[model samples]
Target: MRRSGPVRALLAASAAAAVSAGLVVAGGGAAQAAPAFRAPMPAHVVAPYYETYAGGSPAALAAQSHNTYLTLAFLQTPAAGSCTATWNGDATTPVSKSVYGKDIAALQARGGNAIPSFGGYAADTTGTDIADSCTDVSSIASVYEGLVTTYGVTRIDLDVEADSLSNTAGIDRRNKAVAQVESWAHRTHRNVQFSYTLPSTTTGLGATGVALLQNAVANHARVDVVNIMTFDYYDGASHEMATDTETAAAGLINQLAALYPSEKPSHLWSRVGVTDMPGIDDFGPAETFTTADAATVEHWAAAKGINTLSFWALQRDNGSCVGTAGAGACSGVAQSDWYFSHTFEAFTHSKWTWGKGRSPWSEPKPAPRQAERGSRM
Candidate 1:
């Protein structure tokens, strides 16, 4: 169930993590161990998305092999305002593949946890995003709440990109839906959190993305994370892909710190996340998230206390497939399978604990601040 507000819900989640392991909760899957409450605290998270095989069984990439949490990708609501979660497209009919209800159950049963990501670049042929198809925002939120309740998940990731980003009206609709989902979580005594997945520029969130965050803040949506899709910068080879990503992240962190002026720098960064395509992006050969660049991005996240680190898809985590914008099968790199994930996973381990304020990789803890303000509830 939900709480009074984001602060109460977040605090409750953190407390749940402290409880013994066998404690179970019910939501989008079978009754299972509640997904740990690990936000607002330091976590070495290497969460990646699953797309190529998202509609099929999830055993191919082995989500647990290198990531602490895997992101179930593109839980799109179909066109014509159906609001039913589907994979990567606009279809009048339902996709036969079992998704949130079954696939999620299977993964969690195997000791894996994931956050459902809504929307993606694969919007409909006309550039309409999944979130935009719905005129009834509350209905959209109801679907999201149903997933959280069924899976016992800790969070819902709104991957707002493509046409949706520019749709200011749609952004407001999304913000309202998210706020309602958080409210439902409060009422249900479930601790479901929220995050936004937006595209970024080298310097940070663009005006559109910033507006999305602003709208959420204005709507009182408790966004626990602001995940930046850090690839696809088409600036004519002007900036190194990885370094530009850091620049983008640094800017976003500063923007967030300014927005929630009370939040500590470290805490603000902890709410920031980065996810780049593993290799070439859809923008042709403009840039590629090369294998070597993986360390730079993940290490930067570690040193800066970035909360979540993710790549595009698990299917592309291999080195065998090269060239082409990362669609599926491989990341178009020159390394072995799971190389990027393995490197990014390096940031995660038992060294850091929740609410510790800092990771071993980060500089020694800053003067203690109001830990409650860390969540900026």
Candidate 2:
């Protein structure tokens, strides 16, 4: 998720309070109920992110847009050294229903669920990313487990980018924690999965992103998804948005093939996910994702059998701020409300197969390109 303005100096004086019997204490003496458990996300999904800090009701938006899943962004520590993780780095919004429990439950009741994402651009740069702020591997794992038990979510997205990508210690600690949490999940019979969302070039992940995944492999952490931000090339070149998305994803699959050499081509495709910014991304008009691009990507994703098809946000699904760069409330293009959501919701259907396939928009599986080794994507 994109963050703007000055980073706040918020502080949480103590570590995260322990989860007590699936409940966490909230402000005003309210004991929020734990969200009811929901089935794991389908093998293929169209879960556009809902910006939690943007003050929108996730459930209401899902219903309005007819989307079954949303990746909530993001959870972070309140202070630089705090071990606790909270929504938008606010101490009051810990892993509890009060923060978004009701919304998640409501979504689940409608046969939908939410995926809690951690470490966006702001959290990654501020030293407030949970693993960066907390040194203890156990504590970081506990925080992750708390999120799962509190919300009953099946997947967690670690939006590892910015400075978090280079923090070697933090990266190691995070992967260790992820391994620990996966072990706990296996023992508890919980369906927990982790995804590493990293920035990418027009081609694929750079050395830092590859290093992060390499460490995850080293620590025996299972990464279910390698979702890349497909927009925001910011490389001073005009982009055919949908084509770049396909190439970038193809490039990622190539990289994943090298990373998990034992996996088959189809399996690596199943582990792939691409996140497109709906309209104009942070890089302005040179990288606009039009409604046509959405349809093109959707069809391509369905054909390729990618694991996930998501955009930067559901909030920016409209054209309320045309020609703007990275508008939080609206996509900077002229379109009907929720057009992207409606277009992508087709991806939620389970009919797609993760087998060797082809599409009119699909890029041929490319060999790992040595020339495509750079940081910014």
Candidate 3:
């Protein structure tokens, strides 16, 4: 997702375990480190993307906010024409214990884990997305395998947006690499999952998003989740963000039915994910996602059994910049600190019921009348 602001300065990498014990490269960087303890992702989860560039301890934040899982955004090559993946594209923060290892271990100690993501807006716009920057398919797969061993994360998120979405060659290379990684994981008896985060229209994923998944199917890549960015339509229409999320997701479910004809509607719902941009998104007041929207979406997602519920960034789950659109550090709405986190975290163990004789995965109800659009918050 695009955070409309200047790129924050990269934080100095933390010093922890020695590289010799933390990671060892072999076979042209295709080797894995000794496995660490990792908890499997819950059947349902609420893992907000945590901005690593903006300095803070993820484990500490997770504890304070009562969040057990966080999608770390993002890891990419430090420059064009390089195959090495590092946090915030900084060479100092290589995929080793010297980076966020201790924090991840701490979170895992608390029965939580981190999901490292790749290719956010900046990496997609530049030619630094791992698959786009690196020509070697094996090397891309190696980077993914390295994350699983080094961090012991159960899930990896690929945030495909901006220019990266249109690069068909990059898309193919990515899916192919994912297939390779899954093959390796199976051989090693490792548990890992992949999720693609794509931008969506009100009705559903655009053609490119569908094509991306189609290619995944063609390549025999197992995509455990297809997460849609529910905010930022930018279509110049006044939006009730909560209602749009429902329609957009319903449209996506129908599309998935076409893609996976053998799966039941209930099973398909388990593969769907929704990500909201809290408060005001990049396009400003017309697309504000309010506190009420969070409650509505949480209940809807629980009832439908969606795989995940997340927002753009955990740091923005506050009222620091009310009325300011797309501020990186705040939600731009009046909400208590960590309100979104506390609200969304409930989905991890959510159990909501639909009315009698109604299947949870059946057709969505018509959106409540367009929320009274009065003053722009």
Candidate 4:
């Protein structure tokens, strides 16, 4: 997405604020004191999947232990002629089918929460309308309630994202759909967590998209979490990662926090999202390093009172680390080496030390020797 117009304005304002404070590069993963405004509890990283496990069982376990949250569900439609009936194409029969039920049972068994998300990035006007209908609401809710009751689920993640925000009818349908889902969430008495995969840059979604999210958050108090898609900023085209990417991502989160401070449960619930790719073919040649870079970004967000860190996929980041020696034989190949080698380091280094005397968003400046490399968005 092009970073211009309103987004450019927001970026400029954020850049000015950071420049006034004298931007400093920091090194080391030492726990830093929290600023006055401490973020809420730390949220976990989620992995995306259709039906099969991309990262396999080991990856799932690693993710569960590394973070407190897990999402093991997908987008699907309610079964035909059945109220509150939902089923996925990948799984045979409805959610009650042995295979589907087994999947939900396994996720719950692992101490991870499983929720069947509804809509995604693609435009689904008909689906949105069905979701908006009163009849559909009860049906979908019934299905969700059944899943919760059967699988012992405690939370639901609603993945609602649509393409056309400019049209009046489209906006109305989107709002109605959200309202219906929110209502169902309340009726079920389960923690309904609303998440989205937004563009990493402020301009990534264009003016219409930004307005849609802003309006929704402002009006819908029940919407819990907004998980922005923070990766894919450069698409491997630019050798120099723009300071704008960092500024824009942080600025967008700050803007939302300021807008909905009272509505949000805690500071930690406020998230400046990003995606991690173990290795992407498009991001030029992969440069391996210590877990220092990932830790730096986490620390930056922590200091700013943003606690949620989301990776795009579990399978992608699971790779071998080539270190500073540059690309080796498996330079661009997706190996489990990097993820295995750095998972421990990344998780350990992400710890934030908040105290009574420090600012909510404060972190030790990076040591002079540390260099900022191209981010793995």
How far out, in Å, is residue 26 in model 4?
45
Ranking by TM-score: 2, 3, 1, 4
lDDT tens digits, residue span 201-276, model 1: 8889988888888898899887888898787776666446788789999999888987889887777877888888
lDDT tens digits, residue span 1-377, model 4: 11111111112232233223332111211222211111122243333322222212322333333432345434454432223334332334445423334334334333444444444432233343224322443344455445544444444444444443444444444454455545643443333344444454533444554676666655563444455544344443442222333565655655566556664433433444443323332234432222344455555555444434444333234334333121211223444533422442343233443343222322222233223221111
Better by lDDT, candidate 2 or 1: 2
- Against the true structure, candidate 1 reaches a TM-score of 0.77
* Candidate 1 root-mean-square deviation in Å: 10.4
Residue-wise C-alpha lDDT for candidate 3, range 1-377, written one tens digit per residue: 77445423221121221122232211112233234433346668789998888766676567667787889999989998899999999998899876787777666656677889999999999989998999888889989988877777878899999899899999999999998877766555556789999999998999999999999999998888889999989899999988999999999999999999998988788888999999999999999999999999998998898888999888788787799998887889999988999888778766632233122332223233332221111
Which stretches in model 1 have alpha-carbon errors above 4 Å? 1-42, 52-55, 89-102, 124-130, 284-286, 323-327, 350-353, 356-377
Error of 2 at 160 (Å): 0.7
lDDT (C-alpha) at residue 347 in model 1: 76
Clashes of 4: 25
Give Cα-based local distance difference scores for all models.
0.63, 0.79, 0.79, 0.38
TM-score of 3: 0.85
What would the TM-scores of all predictions be? 0.77, 0.86, 0.85, 0.57
Task: Candidate 3: list runs displaced more than 4 Å.
Answer: 4-39, 352-377
